[model samples]
Every structure is written in structure tokens, then in C-alpha cells.
Target: MSQSSQFSLLSQRRFAPFFWTQFLGAFNDNLFKTALMVALTYDALSWTSLDPGLLNNLIPGLFILPYVVFSATAGQIADKVEKGRLARFVKLLEVAIMLVAGIGWMTHTLWLLIAAVVGMGVHSTLFGPVKYAYLPQHLKPEELVGGNGVVEMGTFVGILLGEVAGALLVSYRPVGIELVAGASLTMALIGLAASWRIPASPAPAPDLRINYNFVAESMRNLRFSAQNRTVFLSMLGNSWFWFYGALVLSQFPVYAKDYLHGDHSVFVLLLTVFSLGIGVGSLLCEKLSGRKVEIGLVPFGSIGLSLFGIDLYFASQAYTNTALVDAFALLATPGAARILVDLVLIGVFGGLFIVPLFALIQTRCDPQHVSRTIAGMNILNALFMVAAAGVAILLLGQGFSIPDMFLVTALLNAVVAVYIFSLVPEFLMRFLAWLLIHTIHRVATVDVERIPDAGPAVLVCNHVSYVDAIVIGAASPRPIRFVMDHRIFKMPLLGWIFRTAKAIPIAPAREDPFMMERAFIDIAQALHEGDLVCIFPEGKLTSTGDMNEFRGGIAKIVERSKVPVIPMALRGLWGSVFTRDPGNLFERSFSRGLRSKLALAVGMPVAPQEATPEYLYEQVRALRGEWK
Candidate 1:
């Protein structure tokens, strides 16, 4: 019920417990892992005869392997049981694993500790599906973006804090070891308490038979994911982000040590900057997207990712320091701030790229299969991360510098983004609409919520510019299928965008009678399928920046579909670049500088019987208030 912001959800019963429970789980995992890393690095010869390098490499693999093996089965389990109870069960499992880990710590038993590591991995694999799917069930659709941002922020903060705790606490000798054990157990218990407080979330698929066969069930989930093309690709985008993240984050210590000539303090600074960037970027999504699942941010984020990623390489090259420095000394070095800013921007873009994809996955997928779909994505994420490791290894083996690796990853991001956007132009189309509104105009909407949130609706708006449909599309929270003039739909750069958007192209009866007929059929079908269809009832852009005679197509549309007719108007777009300003577009481009201010007003819906083109025209004109 709270639409004001996602921060309000933290005070409510449904989300607060889950947020803390998840945060504690992340914290405990990192704490244990960091403790093990410290033990291996500082005291490996004392604890065991094994090589530290081997353990360093093996531990990450150990943690990720369970995701590959058990995520499918985990998804099925999430769907078959109540989430609150399962979360509590998982938390208890954590306590048991930490107890074993505490013993391993006290006894200095490497094998037992390694087993504990795998157990923690299994615990995480089980929780992955529920972690994502749980939010959609409890939060309102509009609240999803903010909810995910907070979750991501919490996860990163926990990782940072846990790492610091493990490293610092383990450095104080025997007391430090004892502290590590105590902290892990205490955090596990706290997490269990938090989970116990989570409200019951009923299973979406209660009657579905449980499938114990991991491989078969995994395939079934993958199949379910494939049924929706957009959701599946969004999952792939999500996984690719993990690949990019793992590769870049894993390299920070080495980059700090070898390239920047900095000590542990510098490494921590780099990691901290990156994590904070992601947190800031994640939080910005709710504001930038207007509290909707806006895929446009995906492309924007990717662009920033690639751009800053390349800049990082150059920034690293600018670092002239050769002697090892502490965090403060590193800050004193020339270009250090630039390198740090690059990391932060990369993180910010990474957050932008990822948060929307997760929200889109949750909001777009089938409710019953959301967990399974997320599980499938987890499996792929694990695979991509493994592949990323291989890529890093191969590149490093070839004697490439860490900065060069950063460059390669940034270029790869751009290539992959272009390919994916080409395959599904919706991402690119939305980006164009989003970009136009963001760059070319400052859009303010009044009573846009008057448009129906669900079911079919005929949106009749006055046409003011060639880009009116795109402006309206960007302003509306929901997607709009615009019926456009066939000629404009066939012209140059804008044509490609129109086609990608799947816009319905229409023509006058004298020019193309069949096209007009098909356009009407498409409108009827779109309305029947509960889509929002927007038509310029004036049938053409006003050549004189005034309303044209209202056409009859809207009458035929409402007569056939009989949906609610919402009257809307775009004000203050006349005489702009996309308008017939002094004859033809492109004559006065950027005359108003970047970000021209504009407003859209939405009037109440008229009954279908009263939804004549003339009536809608007058309503739109009333809202417009002589802006033209």
C-alpha cells in the first residue's frame, strides 16, 4: 500500500525481517570465507602442509560449485514450501554449518574447514531462488525496484563489513581465532532469529509434485524460462553482469598490489569505492525509472560500464607511483582519485545494469515459476563466472597486464550489449524513448495515473510532434503500442526504432487500403490481449502546430474493442526539433539546448459509447490549455 518509497517497506513486517535475514546470511558467508583466507595466507604452513596458492584458487570454486549442481533442485524446493518456514530452516542449517566451522577453527583442521565451506555454499544455493522470488510475492509491483536496490545495497555492505571483521579479528593471534569462531556462530544465530520473524509467504505452486531428480528438474526450469524470450534474455544479461563483476572484483587486490603499488589499505579503498558506487547506483534506479521496471536503464548502465571500464585502464596507466603506499599515501599520488572515480562509476553503472534486469525478471515471469526462472539464471550465472575465471586465467597466462584485462572486459561489454540489443530491440527501443525524454526534454506529467493500470485502454492523445508517440511512451508507466503513419514508420533512423518497437503502421485508404485494414485489425487484437494502444485521433501531426480535424479510426477502434478511452495531451512540444518548427525537423536541432521542459496532462477516461474522436479531441484540447 505504501507507494511513497521503498524505505517505508523497511518499517513494515513483510520486508524488514527478510532484509536483515538476507544481510546476515551474506555477512556470515563472507566472514567465514575471509577467516579461511587469512588462515591460509598468514598461517598456512603452521596449519597444514598444503600450498596457499592452491587453496586460494580452490576456495572460490568450492563456494560456486554448489550453485551449479543444486540450484535447480533448490528452486523446486522454494516453490513447494512456505517461504518463511523455509527461510528459518535454512537459517538453522547455517547455525549447524557455523558450529562445524567453529570446530575447524579451534582444531586448526583444514579438511573440516573446507567441508564447512562447501556446506555454506550449499546453504547459499538453497537460498538463492527464495531470496529473489520472495520479494515479488510480498512487495507491490511498483515497490520492486526499490526493494531490489535495498537488497543489493545490504548484500554489498554485509560483504564489506564481514571481510573487514574476518581479516581484522583473525590477526590478533589465538584470541582472534576464538573471536572469529564466536562471531560466526553469533551471526548465524542472529540470522536465524531474523528469519523466524519473517511473515509466512504461501507457496505459489502448492499442489505441484516435487521433483527430486536434479538434472531433470533443472531442464524443466530452463524450459520454463525459455518460454518467455524477454525474461530469459534478461536472465542472461543478469548472468553476464556477474561475470563482469567477478572478473573485475577478483582482480582488485592484484591490481592494487602490482599496478598501483599500494598495500592492503589501498586494496580496501578500491573495494570500498566500488561497493559504494553500486549501492548509490542501485538506489538511484527507483528515482531514475519513476518506480517502474524500466529496461532503458539496462542500456544506460551498460554504456557507463563499458565507458568507465575503458577509462579505468587509462587511469591506471596514469598512476606514476612505484613504491608501496598506504591508503592515505595512495590518495596523495597523482591520478589516484581518477582511478578511484572510475571504479566507483563502473560500480554505479553495474548497479544500473543489474537491478532493472532482476526486477524485470521478477515482474515479467509467471508468478508460480518465478523461483524456478531465477534458479535457472543462477545456474547460468555460476557458469558465466566460471567462464570469466577461465578468461582471466588465460589472459593472465599470456602475460597481459591487469589494466589490459580491464580494457578487454570493457570492450567485451560494449560488443555483447550491442549484440543483445540487436537480438531484442525492445531494450534499444526503450532506451531511445527513454533517452529522448531524458536528454531532449524534461517531462512532467499531471494525473497520468488516471490511465488504467490494467486491462485494455484506448489512449487518445493530440499529436504535437513527430516524436509525440515516443514522448508519450516514455511518460507512461506502462508500455504503449502506438499506431503511426506508415510513411513516418518507413523513414530513416526513426523507422528502424518504430519497427523495433512493433508499432502499428497505418496509411490513408487511397495510398494503401490493405495496410489501413491490417492496422485496424492489429489495434483490435492488441486491445483484446489487454495491451495499451495509443492513437493520434487527429491522424497526423499538425503542420501548423494546431489540432487537425479528428479522424474516424478511434471510433472504429472503440466500437470493436470497447475498452476504456483515456484522453491525453502533450503540451509545449510544438516548434521543437521533432516538430514542424519553421518547416521540417532537423532545421533547429538543439536550439533549446539539452533538456527542454515539457508537460503531459491526462484527463479521466470517457465511456466507450462517448469515446468519439471529436469528444476525445476536445478533452485533449482542454488539458492542453492552448499550449500550442
Candidate 2:
């Protein structure tokens, strides 16, 4: 769970070379794009007669055009071909394209340069599926989040460095153009060199026949991706992030110039701030998630994005001055620092928002279709970015200010978050679990690995308090279905949370015989389907913070569908507010308040035949002995 362990992947041949290969690709793309953008926007050259506005917009469209047109075919190619070999080929193509781009830069040949842009777009489209799909093939499930964080951090860092390098190199008079060309070519070659060191990854589906008809193939890939509910929704969330990023970034130049009244250096400063924030945030994800695929960060990230975005709108509503300022002067300005902070926070929150979703998609999707699924995600991302541009144009045409646009996008983000969370309540449930552990207690879990990583299992624990299930669920790496008293499941606000978590509600036969029977049936089916079912053998929370006699309901469960039973103990929460103390549950819930310490100890799994109610009770009691 340490940061070094997460970062040690850098020293391994399995990850490092692929990391640089991707890094160089991203660097080259931004390098060329920035050079072209500066050339078009600032009248750095008189090579073309087209309107600057038209060219400025046309460039982004041309670059992303391939993602829409060729991503499906690219996905199939990734699946059918060996990845290491394909990556080298892609890098070689980048070198060739850069060579052509260099010639265009030297001669100021607009068409040639534009062709290079389109070529890079295709290169990216081909590599897109390979980038994400490569990780799961090489890294373990627990290492995925950290690995992805490193990759994302490297990508954004490359982008930032490329943009800065391009802008600086372009500013140096006549030799500037040649330097841009040289840099692109040099980076491409370096990328090719790095790609050579990547270890081999055989084709996942060598028999998948090529289908050149991109339109129909794209639809098919989309359909394939949609078949998995969580993966597809994750794709939608990823696309929405792109949409939000595109809208915010597309306005930076104008916002910097007209609103902040800053010069080019100031614009670079803004980019640097946001870029560094993302790099830091992305790297921080590994530690925040404790080296797991923790989606709780998603909701946390969304909330920060909305809050900061809205604040940014208000922060930039009135600039301190209308006169242009250099980077230093801009920082020195009274209110300018707030704008910069907001930008940085927005980027930080964005990094937090995106990394988990990417990891989730890679790990959750079918192994065979990973590349194609990524291709589908790329296609959707392209469409969302394009739609983002269109929406920006439409709103700007209506004479809205950039700040107003930010506000609108912020509001739209809130709406999108709510919609997605509703569709997959696990996100919200995880958030709640994460919140409970983070705010209410510092939960230390031991031997949580005893819980099966996959397949059917029965988790037997001594129920200590009302919040015991949430704590256990949060600490567990895999999802759990808890069997709780129907009354607690029907509690006011807590009821909805339990239902969303898919917790089974059980009752005594005397209270509701039909419900009790239905609960047992659900438990058997869940176990039959290879899900993890957690049941408190005592069948109720401890009223006196002591052990209760084991119930026969657990025996009924094992009789119906036997599975490995993991014995666990809750070693804290004796007097916490959620416990049934001297007063009502509500009155005692926050008695220990914030930062209360707790521990959950999971014992070795007992075989189904040996896992009687009494045995599990004794195991849990032993585990909890001293603390209890």
C-alpha cells in the first residue's frame, strides 16, 4: 500500500518502455498541434489564404476526424495483430509523418503540415485501443489503478511539455520553424526506440477477420461495448470528461487574452498550472485508493469539478485590470491568483475523475474484446469532443461570455453526474461506504485477502453495529451482498442506501414468513451465481457489545448452496452512535464522532463442510477477543 510499491513498476521491463513509447507519442502530437495552432492564430506565417478562425477550428476537427473514421478498424487491427509489433509500426509511422511535417514546416507548405496532423490523428486512433488494453495484459488487478495513474500522469506531462516546448521554440524568429520540425522528428525517433524495448504481447484474437467498412464496424463495436452495462456506462463517463475538458480548454486563449488581459507568457502559465495539477492528482490516486480500483474517487472528483468550475466563473467575472500583463505581473495582480488556483483545482479534480474510470473499463471488460471496447470508447470520446466544440460554437454565437460558458458547463456536469449515478447506484453506494470509513472512523483491515478475490463465498461475521456492513463492504476489495435484518434495511435514509447496495433484506419467520423464505432463496441464487454473500450469524446487532448465540439461518444457507465461509470480526464500534446504546440508535450514532478508530479482522476461510454456525462464531470471537 506504499507509494514506492505502486511506483516500482517503473523499474520493470513490462511497463517502463511502453510508458515512454506512449509518452513520446503524446508529446509529439501536442508539439505539432501547438506549433500549428500558434502559426494559424498569431499570423506567424502567410502560407495560406484561409481565414484564421476557419483554420483554427479546422485543425482540431482534422485531428480528431480519424478517431471517428478509423477507430473501429484500428481496434480490430489491435486485436488481430501482436501489440508490441503493432506499437513499433505505429511509432515508425509517426517518424515518417514527422519527416513529412518537417519538410512542410521548412517550406511553409500548409497542405503538407495539415496532412501531418491528419496522419497523427490516424496514428493516435490506432494506438488508442492498444494503450488501455495493454495494461490489463501486463499488470495484476490490484496494480491496475497505480499503473493507469502513472500512464495518465505521463500522458498529461508529455502534453504539457510538448505545448510549452512548441510555444517557446516557435517564438525564436526564423530558425524557430526548423526547430519545430526537428523536435517532432527527434521525438518520433525516440518513441520508436522506446517501442523497440517493449515486451511481446501476442494477438488476443488473431482470427478476427478484417472489416474495412468502418461505418458498420463502428456500429458493431459500439453494440459490443454496450452489452456490458458497467463498461458501457464507464465509457459514457469517460466521454463526458472529454466533453467537459474540451469546453474548458477551447476557451483558454480567449479567456486569457480578453478576460484576464494576459500576454502569451501568462497563457503558458495557466497551462502549466493546470497541467502540473493533473500530474500531481493522477499520481496521488494510487495512494488515495490504497492501490485498488476505488471508484469512490469518481464521486469525490465530480463534486470538486462542479464546485471549482462554478467558483472559477465567479472568480473571473471581473478582472483586476484590462491592461495586458506578463506572467509575473499576472501573478502579482490582486485577484489573478484565484483564477489560477481555480484552474489548477479543476485539473486536479479532473485527474481524479478520469483515472478510475479508465482502470474500471480495462479491468471489467471482456479480455478478448478489450481493444475493441477501447476503440468504441475512443469513438465515443471523439463524438463527445466534437459535440463539445459544436456546443461551444453555438453558445459563443449567442454572445455569451467565456465565464458564462464555464457556468453552463459546470451545471451540465452536475446533471450528467446525477444521471450516471442513478443508472449505476454502485458508484453512489461506494461513495457512501468510502464516506463512512473516511469520516466516521479510521478502519484498519487485517487479512482482508482471506476474502476470495473471485467466485462464490459465504462471509460470516459478528455484527457489532448498524454500520458494520458498510465498513466491511468498504474494506473489501470485491463487492459483497449483505443479508441484513429487514427492519434495518427499511430504515429511513439508510434503506435506500442498502437497497442500492443490493443487500438482501431478511426477517424472522414469525415476523414475515414469506419474506424470510424469499431472502433465503435469494441467498442461494446469489451464491449459485458465484457472488459473495455476507451474513451475520447472530442475525442481529449486539445490544450489549457482547457475543450472541449463533442462528440456524446460516446452516440453511449452506444446506442450500455450500461455499467457502470466511469468518470475520468487527473489533470496534462498541459505543459508536450506530450502536444500540442507552438511548435510541440515532442518539448514540455519532457518540465517538469523527476519527474514531476501528479494526476489521478476517480469518482464514473454512471449508463448506466444516463451516457450521458455531465454528464461525468461535472463529470470529477469537479474532475479536482482545478488542472486544
Q: Highest TM-score: which candidate?
A: 2
Local accuracy of candidate 1 as per-residue lDDT tens digits, 1-628: 5559777888988999999999999999988887787667657788878655445546766777788889998888899899999999999999999999999989988888999999999999889999999999998877899999999888888887777787678867659889999999999999999998899999998887878788888888888898889898998899999888877876765677678887656766887889889888998898888888889899999999999999999998888889889889988899999999999999899889999999989988888898888899989888888787778777877988889989999999999999888888988888888898887789888998887767899898888888888888887777788899998866898888888888999999989999999999999999999899999888778878788878899889888988899998899898887776675445556566778888999999899999887787889889999877
Candidate 2, superposed: residue stretches over 4 Å from native: 1-4, 44-54, 583-593
The TM-scores, one per candidate, come to 0.94, 0.96
Give the poorly placed runs of model 1, Cα more than 4 Å off: 1-3, 41-44, 47-57, 583-593
Full-model lDDT, candidate 2: 0.87
Query: Residue 540 in candidate 1 has what lDDT?
Result: 78
Candidate 2 per-residue lDDT, tens place, 1-628, comes to: 4435867888899999999999999999988987787776666357667655445556776788899999999999999999999999999999999999998998888899999999999999999988999999999888999999999999999988887787678767878898999999999999999999999998899999999999999999999989988889989999999999878876766677678887667767877888888888888888777677878789888988899999999898856688879899998888888888998999899999999999889877888999999999999999998888788778877988889989999999999999999998888888888888887789888888778777999998888888888898888887799998999866887889889889999999999999999999999999998899999989777888898988988888888887888899998778887776567666566566678899999999898888888888899899999785
Candidate 2, residue 549: Cα displacement in angstroms equals: 2.0
